[model samples]
Target chain A: MARRMLNQDLIEALTDNCAPIRPLPHPAWRALVWFAVSLCYVAIVVAAMGVRPDFVAKISDPQFATELAAAFLTSVVAAAGAFSAGCPARPAWERFAAGFFLLIWMGAFAVGCWRDVDAYGVSGLLSHSDIYCLPTILAISIPAAALILSMVKRGAPIAPFVTIGLAALASTALAEAALRLSFRQDPAVSVCIWQFGSVVLLTGIASLFGRALLHWTRRDALIASFQAHRR
Target chain B: MSELSDTSNDRESRWRALMASAQDGDHAAYRELLSDLFPVLRRFVLRKWPNAHDTEDVVQEILVSIHTVRQTYDRRRPFTPWLMTIAARRVADAARSRYARGANETTVDILPETFDGDGAKSEQETRDDREALRRAMAILPAGQRQAIELIKIQGLSLDEASQVTGKSIGSLKVGIHRAIKAMRQALERNG
Candidate 1:
């Protein structure tokens, strides 16, 4: 007769195959790391493209600074939220707080954009380089998105959709920041379509991948990985 | 629903230590911790899923989840909440699965886990009882058959078999090896 696997036997298999267990880093720490990595990329982009000629003058504007600061802060807080969502035992306040940062950033962006309006022609607002916002932002945020997803992978987040959504927000926010630094221009309502489009696209793509990634980290798949390695 | 008791707090401290060792790759400690956790998880899951027979399956899922996310357990933090969070998530997942399956399925595929003195057999439960082994042993050499019948089927130790058969331990081992080969040949021929 075949004996059923006792809890002890199963635990042995799990432990035998387990990855060396260092505590998963705190989500905030990971979020900080992701933000730092994205910042480095943004810095490189700014260096390559060169900061706007009137950077000192334009950057000094409180409205522009507020928008930049809000977007950047959204990346940090949203990262923390994304990381936390993957782990259980997250604080009750985290759900609202993550979205809260995104909302504040969005509000700030709106205010800054509104202040920039001077009844300028659409042509003047977009300029040639400004039209590249969609592609440029998408390109810059790709690595940031990958980095954020890696942070989420440090834990097997049960809420993959929400977790990845936050990660996408953090990533696209950094891309927006890079764009603003490299090619500052007067904000236009039409320009935002491309800006927000990056956020939506990244979030959508990541969420699709997030489901599979999180699902793979489930208990059965984990044991399978260890078991396969043994062979 | 009720608050975790002092005893639970005490247990958490002990589990935390075991987990710390397990995280460091001490399989023995990991096994002990899982063994201990099983009963507690069973009690809690059964309490929540009072009449559901798949309580044991959910408990198993929780154990697996804990194993998967063991690295998430912070040494300085209380272990209970971390463990409870996993258990809660798995239990909810089980509930959702059952609810989804309830819509059209007439039968549950994997049965509700039952406690039996001998334990429930797995889906691939074997039919090779001692009688089957004895019949198989009949196809072996005389010495090999004796080794298979007495030492293997009857579960006698090699030393005990040496004493009973007046054979050395070395010879007994050879006989058992020969017996296994002969049985394999017989099975292959039958096939």
Candidate 2:
């Protein structure tokens, strides 16, 4: 009888020691979505450049080309880091760097789009048309959508998005101030409204969507934890 | 001597073959290995955990992890320690979970050997013995309790207990000896 009791106790103890099983977030799905978004961005750039057959030869200076390539590579690294925020093990520094680079890339792209229209003398585009602010809007909105989705899926806190949005708005305001001082041109109110409005909209959408996604996925476990505490 | 050495080598080769076959996704071989492992794993967990209700759950989780990460195991390694590593992690996780849930409030009491016979001891004597054992156990250092559990209750050889606890064999034996001696002394005083 004592032996049986000992055996029972042993069995009981072993059972108590069993570990809880936690489901790992699916890595493949995240990787696939990131790859698709990257491909789409590359496709858009290729289309924008019109894929001219003689475009490669037009860049005659190797040194200048090297600098341009280096800049592009840095931008790509930033994009990759932003995309990698979806990984479960992403560190804080990586997320911060990714966010920083993403802001720089968006600003650069917006300025480049505006300048391209002006330099090419494109009619019906932002430069010749009454809608001089359209290029910046498009540039900001497109990347904002992608960045918002990535940030939301990665479960970034509300504060980072808000800070980034405010920073973007402030940077645009600063750039406008600089332009006014240097070129003596009056800053457009429409540009300021568009920049601030886009930041607010993107930040709001990303935080809302990310919170919703986390709530939906972890609802059961969250509810269980609460219930367990009550008991 | 040569024949004995050849036979020993043959046994090792056979064990290696079994391990290789199991690693290659052979269900029969895997089942065979698991059958041999189940008792040892159960014993190891029981000594560490002592809670009946959670043992099966932990064992199932450990088995599932073993299945999932089977590819990561090296065929050349002895399977016992590999399995024990998983078992230890599972046990630690369970302990954490229990602590988080605030379910570790049960009072444990150990009784003297005199209280064992069905009709030999009076009810008062049995209760006293139980109280004495409980006091003795409470007074023991944590390492000594662990040593007693692993060596005496779990029936692990001192060397095996040392391996499980990551203590030197000599230290583990001394710990177990000291714990048992303390418990006996505590019981004698009460008697």
Candidate 3:
């Protein structure tokens, strides 16, 4: 009887707490909005950093162009996947929608590395240390990550790890692409190991805080405030 | 089987309508919807985590979660799958947290027999300690005593004790804290 009364009290509190709310837009639509805004910010950052002197030449190269395009597509698709994961009842496959482009992006670098080995007898694969890649990607991704996190908090946090991981992937991948336009780093092996590695590392680290970042804060606040009101 | 499916379909549509109304800030509709969902969610939690310490608590949690994220529910889509998805995720989370809490605890069903073990009390000593504890508890204020009895002896959660005692959860926690301190002081004085 006490348990039932407690539930009844909870129900009454919840009902009193109810307010009209606008349903979230489709995940794909939200992803597009995020991508568009993020792209604009990235463009401004790239322009401010000054495009690499060899950027035009690099863009003209078929392999580099394909790799860059793959990265861009991966970011957009991953953004969609992140939003979809935040919503309940979305297909599980939506969580992996970006994997195809990610593989293609990785494959492009693998092909470059193989070509380097073939052309320069493994010497072409070597490059000077580029520790700067990690920090640069992290800096560029901060705004995108903040934007996506705020947008995603509006949805259900059923799959926080997946959602946050994908959001990280989306932002970091875009940041890496933006870095390619502004920083003239060479050797596909170096790019693959350092730049790509940084993206994965950042995503892994960000995902570890998923539950902390996305939780039932709203529900807890509502319950707390309602109970206080009753008291 | 068809009849069961039909019933489920009927339930789904009705719930969707109720949810839509609830989203419009219709208190009656929201109340009815939650009342309907509670039993179903309780059964769902039971099936998902049969070993759960308290199925109703988990159900209430899921309901709170649903209420929090109700804006994410698109009326254009079917409601059952969305509801079930959240329910399953919350069950998994509850199990994870339970395991985490269990990791810090050591459950002992029976104390091992000891021969003159260090710090082990004799029967007389144990009886004296129990008497001292009883006396300490007796001297505590009514609220403090009730708090210890409900939260410590009875092993009820603060929320549950709050509900039963009609005191706020914050007060219950404060009561428990003060009660323990008073008991410790009383015991020390007796010693």
Candidate 4:
């Protein structure tokens, strides 16, 4: 009968429009992991500085300064590894990871300077008297710079990378000032090596990590905004 | 107490009755309402489709959608236009699918122009005429079929069909005129 056929057709159509079954993933897990790892690293670095004032004193020697540069460069490499695992589709994950790396690197510089302030005196550390050792700082930073440049080329947002880089640079400048004030020493060749070398190393590490993980560059962000509007 | 107080309120009583039955999952009431409302939806789809086949398909799709989204529907609002909107969108989707499958293969064939003016034909003759129209419509090119559906069966105004089909009104008019002329010629030849 026509009535039966119509009823059958209506039943068939109704079943197709039921709500979809699959659940969407929660957005918080990626951010939480980045925060935990970065905070743990900050804790370890602070603890190490607290227990080892002798290690800070040894870093003033030229050989020790080179080793410190290599260690900082290694941290930059570690940051790149951290970034590789951190970047996800969500914006919250990217912003959290960026903030985490900024905090860890800045904390490391703070701890390092706080440990060495007694050997270098305030005026000796703060003044442009330490400008001669700029090359040593640039040398330490080379690896980090290379890393950041590679990341920038790949697609990270340049602004965040630049911001983290500037902050690290400022942290190094502050550390040098603290070292000179605490040590009561003039801005010597070793101070130049310590200050500039640390700045370059931190900047390079932050930039490289930024480049590898942050792919939602300005262009991608703009395109995503446009797509959201279209939707 | 409120129920006793509101017993004199006709609107509140009707709302309570409708909500209570609907929430109780009374599918029979839902189906009754749907069946009562089906003719308007069928007429809407018929405008989008020249033949009975697609008209039936679109009607089924709309009914399913209404049932699926029933939970979201506000009991206070009149449901007919909302139902029609879904029907119209489904019809448009069907039209787009037909269009994407390509435009040139199908062509509409009109029914014979020889029905008696006295309306004295037997029921069998009327059924036969409906069958012939269905068969003729099936043979049409997609564009011509859509044109005939929108202009003839659907009886949409030229401007309305133009907006639905995303074609200029002038082009739709020309297409419909050509399709009708072709169908008439085809029917005459078949006779």
**Candidate 2 C-alpha lDDT tens digits along B45-145:** 89998874667556655554454444334454554455566567666766776787677465559644653784678888778766787888877998898
lDDT ranking from best candidate downward? 3, 1, 4, 2
lDDT for A118 in candidate 3 is 90
**Candidate lDDT values, in order:** 0.72, 0.47, 0.87, 0.47
User: TM-scores for all candidates?
Assistant: 0.70, 0.28, 0.78, 0.25
- Give the residue spans of candidate 3 off by over 4 A: A1-5, A218-221, A227-231, B108-191
Residue range with the least summed lDDT across 10 consecutive positions in model 4 chain A: A216-225
Worst 10 residues of 1 chain B by lDDT: B122-131
Best by lDDT: 3
Cα distance off (Å), candidate 4, residue A38: 23
> Across all candidates, what is each one's fraction of true contacts kept?
0.40, 0.00, 0.58, 0.03
Q: Comparing 1 and 4 by DockQ, which wins?
A: 1
**Candidate 3 C-alpha lDDT tens digits along B114-175:** 74453587888777777888999999999898788766865666665675677999998888
Clashing pairs for model 1 are A86-A157
Q: How far is candidate 2 from the true structure (C-alpha RMSD, Å)?
A: 19.7
* Candidate maximizing TM-score: 3
- Quote the lDDT for B119 in model 3: 50
For B1-191, candidate 4 gives per-residue lDDT tens digits of 78866663654444434433443465554444565557767787887676645566567556654543344333444444444555665566567766777576666596455456326687888887777777777777887888787667655566546545668988888888887877777777667
